[model samples]
Target: MTDYETIVYVERESVARLMVTALRAHGFSPREILDGGLPGIGTGLTGKGLAIAVPASEARDAQPLAEALLKDMVGK
Candidate 1:
């Protein structure tokens, strides 16, 4: 029942999990939301989309770290 600010949207579960791990590594707690890409409950059941959220106060610090981690993951 807590509110969270969306930090990133990822299509792959692996990436989302990795992001969460990386965020935690840097001392930020993150929450994942599986938002169905399609309409209705079916999307929630079978969607490949995901969202990573963190506390509003932590978002500013988390973003750059997350971006860096993702870049490292993607080899960019």
Candidate 2:
């Protein structure tokens, strides 16, 4: 595992939710997703829109799967 984390940004909350689900299916904890928008804006919090946080330990495994899921399903 590395010493750093990475973030993935998606345009829509539905896509973010889908990514969270896909990551979970691929063995990620639900907590890994940052849920970075929509709710944030609603609550008057600054956000980066839809985002997921890949913890350092999970990043190596999660990256490819996330990219695939986003590309294949979300058309990212």
**Count of clashing residue pairs in every prediction:** 0, 0
Output the number of the lDDT-best candidate.
1
**lDDT of candidate 2 vs native?**
0.65
Put down candidate 1 lDDT per residue, 40-71, tens digits, no spaces: 33313435346678988899998888778767
CA lDDT of every candidate? 0.72, 0.65
State the lDDT at 31 in candidate 1.
84
- As for candidate 1, its clashing pairs are none
Question: On a 0 to 100 scale, what is the lDDT of residue 67 in model 2?
Answer: 79
For the record, the alpha-carbon RMSD of candidate 2 to the native fold, in angstroms, is: 4.4
- Candidate 2 per-residue C-alpha lDDT over 1-76 given as tens digits, one digit per residue, 9 for 90 to 100: 4354554667666677788888888887544444344453522243545556666788878878877887987666
Residue 5 in model 2: lDDT: 55
- C-alpha lDDT (0 to 100) for residue 21 of candidate 2: 83
